[model samples]
Target: METDLLIIGGGPAGLHAALTADRAGARVVVADESFSLGGQLRQQTQWLSNLPGQYGYGKKRGTWVNEQLINQVGASNVQVLKKHTMIGSYLNGNIGVSDGDKTFEIQSRKNIIAPGAQEEAKVFPGWTLPGVMTAGAAQILINREKVLPGKRAVMVGSNDFSLEVARQLNSCGITVEAIVEEKNQIICSDGELVKTLENVPVYTNSTIEIVTGAGEVEHVVIQTPDGLKEVNVDLVCIANGFSPILEPFEIMNCHFVYQKELGGWLAAYNIHLQTTNPSCYIAGNAAGITDFGSILLTGEIAALSALEAMGFISSAEGTEQKSRCWRELANLESEKVLQARTEMLADYHQKHELDLPDYFMKIKGGKMYG
Candidate 1:
C-alpha cells in the first residue's frame, strides 16, 4: 500500500492527523492495532472538559466532541487498516504493518508515528497473578468486555484516572477494598476529584507489599508507617503511570528525550512535529504522554506539516496555519507542564523507582520489573 501520508496509529491523534491531511488534499492511510477507533477515551468513564480559550478546549470539550471527531474521521473516506500493527519503519519512509499472520509494506511520502503509550506496572509480589491487572486493563474489561476480574478490588495509585476507575468499579457493584497511594496526598488538582476521594477510603503513604493467593489474587499485603497489613481482595489494579511506545520509531533511530514530566522517554519533535528525520513525524502519546486534547492538536499540526513538506499545500498557507497551531501547542504544553509539576510535588513519587516485590524474581527470573 502507498499513500501520501501514512499514519501509524488509529487513536485520537492518528485519526485526527488522517482527517486533517485528507482534508488538505493528501491521500492518507491510517493503520491501527485496535479493532476500532476512539483509543483510551473509549475506556474512560466520563469526559473531561477543557477550560474556555484553551488550545485543546474545543478539540476535546465534551463527549459530543469525541464522538463527532471520530465520526468525522470515519466519514472522511480515509483508508483505515484496522487491526494492523506497525512493527517497523525504514529510513526511506516505508512502514512494516502486520495483522497476526500476514504482513504488508506501506510506502509513504510522509509517515506519522502515533503508536501511543503503554501503562507501566510497578512489580510487586503476586502481581502476575491472574486476578491482578493494570487499571487501564481493568477498565477495558469492565467497560468494553463487560467482565469483572473479581468482586473485591484494591486500587493502587493517586491519579485522576485511578480515582475515576475506582468510582466506575464501585458503581458496578464491585467492592472497592481501598484506594491506596504511596504518598500522603491525592495528586490531582481537580476539585471534583478531591471531593470524590472523600467518599472512598483512601490510604496514604502505603504500598502493596505482597499479593497472596493459590492461583489468583485472594489477599493483598500493604506496607505503611503503621506496619504491614493484609486486606482480602480478589483483584488488584496497579495504576502506575504510562511509558511511551517508542520501540518502532526507536528502531529507526529517532531522536528522543527522557522527560520525567512526560512519563519517561518521548520522541523529540519540533513545533511542526517533524522528528529527527524530516520524512518521519510523530504526535500524541507516542510523542509524549499528555492529555488527549493536546495529542489531537499535535496530530493536526503534524499532518499539516507533512502536507506542506510534500508540496500538497502552499508554504504561505501552511506557515499561517502552523503559526496558529504552534501557539496553541505552546499554550497546551504550558498547561500540562504546570499540572505535571503540581502532581509531581503532591505525589513525591519518583518515576520507575518503585520497589519491586521479591515474588517477581521467583516466577519471571531475575528480570527487573518496569
Candidate 2:
C-alpha cells in the first residue's frame, strides 16, 4: 500500500501522530497489530489529570480521553488497518505488514514508528502456572474483556504501574492479597499514595519463592526481609517494567545499547526524535519511559520532524512546531525520566565513533561526562 505516511502501532503515540500528520495534509495509513485502536487504554482504568496548561495529555489520564482521541481519529476518516502488524522493516525503506496469513509491502514518503512497549515478565517458581499472568494481561482481561483474571490475586512489582494495576483489580471486586515489591520502598507518586492504602500493603524486598496449586494458582510462598509468608490467592500478576518493542527498529538496523533505565536495550535517537537511520522515528515507551505528557508531545514532535524531512511543511513552520516540542520536551528532562535516555543516545554515538551533541554532553553531569 502506498501512502504519504504510515504509522505503525495504535497506541497513544501512534494515534496522536496520525492526527497530526493528517492535519498536515498527508494521506495516512495506521497499521496496528491489535484488533482495536485503543492500545493500553483498553487495559487501564485510571484518570491522571495534567496540570491545567498542556491540554489533557497527562500520565494515566481517564478512559474518557482515550475514547475522545479514538473518536476524533475516526471522525477524521484516516484509514486504519487494524490487526495489521508491521512484521519486517528493511534497510531500504520498505516494510512488511501482516494481519494474519498475508503480508503487504508498505512504501511511504514518511513513516512514524510508534509500536509502543512490551510489558516484561519475570522468572519465578511456577510462574508458568495457569493463573500466572502479566499485570498488563490482567488489566486487559478485566478492563477490555470484562472477565476477571481470578477471584483473588497477588501482585508483584514495585512501581506505580503495579500499584495502580492492583487498585484496578480491587475495584473490579477481585480480592488482592498483597503487592510484592522488589525495591525496599514504594515508587508510587504522591498522587498515587491512595492506591497503596487501598487495603493492600506492599511487601518490600520480597520474592515469590514458589506458587502452589493443582492446575491454576492457589497460593504463593513469599520470602521477604522479615520471614517467609504464605498468601492464599488465585492469581499472580507480574508488573515488572517493560522492554521497548525494538523489533521494528531493529528490522531497520537501528543500533541499541544496554540502558537499564529505559528498561533494557533501546534504540539510538536524538532529541529531535530521529533515529540513527534518518527516515525512521520513535516515541513514547517504545523509546524509553517518561510521563504521558512527554509521550504525547514526543509523538507530535516526531510527526513534525518527519513532515519537515518530507518537505511537507516549510522550514519556518517546522521551527514554530519545534518550539512547542522542545518546550514540552524540557518539562520531562530534569525529572530523571529522559536523563538515562540522553546518556544512552550519547553512548550510542560514541560507540559509532561520533561526537556527542554539544549541549547533551553538559547535561549528563560535567565531571561524569566524557
Candidate 3:
C-alpha cells in the first residue's frame, strides 16, 4: 500500500497523529495489533487528567476520550487496519505488516511509531497463579470484558494508576484488601489521583514477600515498614508501572539513549519528535513516560513534523503549531520529565553535531548514561 503517512498504533497517540496528518491533507493509514482501536485506553474506566486543569477543574473518562478519538478518526479520510502488526522495516523504507494471515508492505512518505508502552510484570512467589495479573489486565477484565477478576483483591502499588484500579475494582463490588508501595510515600504524579482513595488503605515502604493460594491468589504477605502483614484476598494486581515498547523502533534501526526518568531507553528525538531516522517519528508513552495530555500533545507535534517534512504544510506554520503544543505540554508535564526531555534533545544534537537551540540547555544533575 502507498500512503503519505503510516501510523503504527491505534491508541490515543496514533489516532491523534492520524487525525492531525489527515487534516493536513495527507493520506494516513493506522495499523494496530489489537482487534479494535484505543489500545489500553479502551480498558480504562477512571477519569484521566488529559487536559490541563482537568485533574481538579474538570473531568474526562478515559473511555470517553478514547471513543471520541475513534469517532473523529472514523469521520476522517484516515484508513485503519485493525489487527495489523508491523513486523519489520525495509532499507528502502517499506514497512512489513501482518494481520495474522499474510504479510503486506506499506510504503509511506513518513511513519509515526506510537505503539505505546508495556506493563512491567513483577514476579514473586505465587505470581504464576491464574489470578495474579497486572493492574492493566484486571482493568480490562472489569471495564472491557465486564467480568470481575475476583471477589477480593490485594493491590501491589500506590501510584495513581494502581489507586484508580483499586477504585474501579471496589466499584465492581470487589474488596481491595490494601494497596502496597515500595516507595517511602505514595508515588502519585499528582495528588488529585488519591482524592477518591481516601477510604482505601495504603502501605508505604512495602513489598510483597509472597503470595499463597491453593489454585489462585488467596493470601498475600506484604513486608511493610512495620513488618510482615498478611492479607486475605482472591486476586493480586501488580501495578509496578510500565516500560516503553521500543522493539518495533529497534527493528527500524533507530538510535536510542537511556533516560531512566522517561521509562528507560527511548529513541533519540528532537523538539519536534523526529527520531534519528529523519522520516520516522515517535509519540505517546513510546516516546517517554508522561501525562495523557502531554502524550496527545507529542502525537500532534510528531504529526506536524512529518507533515512539514512531506511538504503538506509550510515550515513556519509547523513551527508555530509545535510551539503552541510545547507550551501546552509544559503545562501538563512534570518537571522531571521536562528536564529529561531537554537533556535528551541536547544529547541528540551534540552527538550529531547539529546546532542546538539557545533555550535548550543541559539540565544540572540529570543522569545521562548514554
Top model by TM-score, which number? 3
- Lowest-lDDT window of 10 residues in candidate 2? 361-370
Task: Score each candidate by Cα lDDT.
Answer: 0.75, 0.77, 0.85
Sequence-dependent TM-score of model 3 = 0.93
Range of the 10 consecutive residues with the lowest summed lDDT in candidate 3: 361-370
Report the number of clashing residue pairs per model: 0, 2, 0
* Candidate 2 accuracy as TM-score: 0.89
- Candidate 1 lDDT by residue in tens digits, 1-370: 8888988888878888898898878999998888887777666656655422433434343345557667888789789888999887655657888999988789889889888889998788788999899989989999878998789999999787787788778878888888888988877566776676576677789898999999999989889778887899899998998888888778767876666877777776655677777788988887777766667777887998999999989978887776565445545454555354234322322232333222222212111212
TM-score of every candidate relative to the true structure? 0.85, 0.89, 0.93
Return the TM-score for candidate 1, rounded to 2 decimals.
0.85
Which digits, one per residue and each the tens of the lDDT, describe model 3 over residues 163-266? 88888899899998888888898887556667777777788988899998888888889998888899888899999888889888888888888999899988
Candidate 2, residues 142-243, lDDT tens digits: the string is: 888899989888988867777778888887899888888878877677554554456776788988999989998997999999999898899999988888
Query: Comparing candidate 1 with candidate 2, which one achieves the higher TM-score?
Result: 2
**Superposing all C-alpha atoms, what RMSD in Å does each candidate have to the true structure?**
10.6, 3.7, 3.8
Q: Give the clashing pairs for model 3.
A: none
**What's the residue-level lDDT of 92 in candidate 2?**
62
lDDT of 1 at 179: 81
